[model samples]
Target: MSDDTDDAQPPRRLNSLEDRNAVVESALDRAIKRGDFDDLPGRGKPLTGLHGSSDPDWWIKQKLDSEGINGVAPAAFQLRKENAVLEDTVDAFTEESDVRDYLAGFNARVREAVMDLREGPPVFTPPRDVEKEVAAWRRRRNAMKNDSVTEAEPGDPEAEPGYQPVDPESVGSPRRWWHRFRR
Candidate 1:
C-alpha cells in the first residue's frame, strides 16, 4: 500500500538558487521598464549630514534631524557646544551675579557629565573659572560704556552728525503705570 501511494504522488520540484535569482532579476527589469524608480528625491546628489566625518552614529543623527528633534544629543556634545559659546554668553549678562550663577550652573553640568559612569562620548569640556569669567564680563561691560560715552559726548567732533545725547535723569526715571492713561 505504501509503494502504491508513493508512486501515485508526483515529485515536488524545489527551485534552485539560480531560479530564485532569475525571478528577482526579471521583476526588477519589469520595474525599471515601467519607470517605477524615476524622479526620486536626492537621486543624483551626494548624501548630506556626512559633514566629511565618518562618525559611527551618523544614521542615528540623521534620523533625529529628519524628525526635527533637538536637545537629545549626548551630554558630551551639548557641553562642547556650550563651551564654544561660553565667552559670548557670559558677556551678555547685565549683572555680575547673573554671570556668576550662569557659570556656576554650566560648571556644575560639566562636572556632572565628567563624573557620569554611563557613557557615550567622553566629556572633554573643561569647567569655566567663575571669577575669571566674571572679571572678563566686567571688563567688556566697562569698555562698552566708555565707547558709548565717547561717541555721545556733547560738542565732540568725533560724535556722529545729528546724534543727540539723551538726558540721563529724564530717561532713567520710569513712568508710573497710570502715566500711560494720562496721555
Candidate 2:
C-alpha cells in the first residue's frame, strides 16, 4: 500500500523462537520456586541493574554449588564399612552372629560397657603373657634397627632419627659461585 512495499515480508515470525524460550523460562522458574532452600547470610543480594541473569534456578544452583565445598556424603560410607570390617579383623576369634545382628549386639554391648565403666570396676589384671609381649617388642625394635639402611649424622637438623644426612655445602658447586650473581 505504501512505498515501503513489504519486500522484507514483515520479518518472518521471530515470535515462535521467543515463545519457545519463554515456555522454557516458565518451566525453569516453576521448578526453582517449588524447591526448598536455605538462605545464605552475608552473601551479596542480587542487583536490579544486572542483565543476562535468569531468576530462581540461578540462585538455587549457586547455593547448591557453594554447599558442595563440604565433601560429598558417600565418601563417609567407606569409614563405616571399614569400621565394620575392622571389628572382625582386630578380633579374629569371638562369639559370632549375623553381620546385622552382630553390629546391633556390639552397639548395645558397647553402650552398656561404657555405662559400666562409668559406674566403675571390672577389676584390672596384669598381662599373663609379659614375656611374649617383651619378646614381641624386642623383635619390633630389632626389625626397625635392621631395616634402617642409612645412618644420620649427629646434630644435623635435616636428618631424621633413622636416616642419612647430606651436607648442604656438598650440594653446591664451587664453580657455581660465579654463576649465582649472573642474571
Candidate 3:
C-alpha cells in the first residue's frame, strides 16, 4: 500500500501568543505581497479622527457634513440661524403692516419654543422691536436704492446714460439655416 503519511499535510498548532502573532504576520505579509491593500480609497491620506473630538456624535456630524446635509442642526442652533436671518426676512416685506405681522408671528413662535420644557441649547434671541426693525429696514432699503441709482449712472464715457453698450461680435449672428427656415 502507498504511504498516506508522506502526502498528508501537518496541522498547525498555535500553542502561544507569539506563535499566533507570527502566523498573523505571515498572512499579512503574503497579502501585502499580493497587493491586496493597494489602490484603496483614501490611501496615503492622513488617518482622520485622530485630532477630532471624542464625542460619540462625531461620526454622524462628519457624515452629515460630507454629504452636504442640512436641517440636522440642534434646535437651538436652528433657532439661532433663523434669528440671524430674521432681519432679512423682515426686510423682504415692503409694507409696514406686513412687516409688523411677520415680526409678531416670529416672536410668537420664539416665545412658544422658549416656553416648551424640551431640553436643548438655550434660545438667546429676544423678541424683536417692530418699530426699530422697520426703521432699520427703511434705512437699508434707501441705501440699496441709492447705491443702485449711483451704479446705473453713465460711468463709461463712450456709453449714454441708462444705456449699456452690447458687443455685436459677442452676440453672434443667427445660423443661415435658421434664417432660411424663418423665411
Candidate 4:
C-alpha cells in the first residue's frame, strides 16, 4: 500500500497561463480521442451571431435565446410581456375552466408584482378581468367555428370565382388549338 501511494503522481500545479492552457489542451485531446464531442448539436453548421452589429447586450441576449430561458426578467417587464400576449394565449385554451385558471394566476402575479417594494420599474400591467376575457374568448371561438362552417369546399358551386373543376372524361381526349380560346 505504501509503494502504491508513493507511485501515484501528485496533481499538476497550474501556476501560469501557459501551464493552464496546456492542461486544458491535453484534457480536450483526451476527450477527442474518447469521442466525447462527436455527436454535439450544430456540429457542422456555421456559428451564428458572429456578424457585425452594434448591440451592447448581444452576448447575454444570445445566451438567453440559445438556452430557451424565459421569465427570468424583472417582474414589471415579465408582467408587461405576458399582458402583451394575454389575448392570444387565452384564445389558445379550448376549455373555459382552463382560461379562468390561467387568468386567475396571471392576475395574482400582477397584483403581487404591484405590491413588491424592491426598487424596479413600476408594474403597469392591470389584472385581467376573468369574466370579460372568458366572454371574449367564447365569442372568438364561436366566430372561428362559424367561419370554418361557412367556408365552401373545393369544387363547390358556392366556391369563389376562377376555381373551375376539370372533367376527367375529357382529360384523355386531345383538343384542337381553338379549344383553349373557346373557354
Best by lDDT: 4
lDDT, candidate 1, at 65: 87
Clashes of each: 0, 0, 0, 0
What lDDT is reached at residue 80 by model 1? 93
Estimate every model's Cα lDDT from 0 to 1. Answer: 0.86, 0.51, 0.81, 0.91
Report the lDDT of model 4 for residue 121.
Answer: 91
Per-model TM-score versus the true fold: 0.46, 0.20, 0.44, 0.53
lDDT by residue (tens digit), candidate 2, 7-109:
6556334368887788778778887797623355533777543687667567655676778754233323433444456434423423233433444544554
Off by more than 4 A, model 2? 1-15, 33-143, 146-183
Pairs clashing in candidate 1? none
The candidate that achieves the highest TM-score relative to the unseen native structure: 4
State the RMSD for candidate 4.
12.8
lDDT score of model 2?
0.51
Shift of residue 110 alpha carbon in model 4, Å: 0.2
**Residue pairs in clash, model 4:** none
lDDT of predicted model 3: 0.81
After superposition, candidate 4 runs with Cα above 4 Å error: 1-59, 65-67, 152-183
Per-residue lDDT for 56-118 in model 1, tens only?
988888898899988777999999999998888888888888999999999999999999969
In candidate 2 the C-alpha lDDT for residue 73 amounts to 31
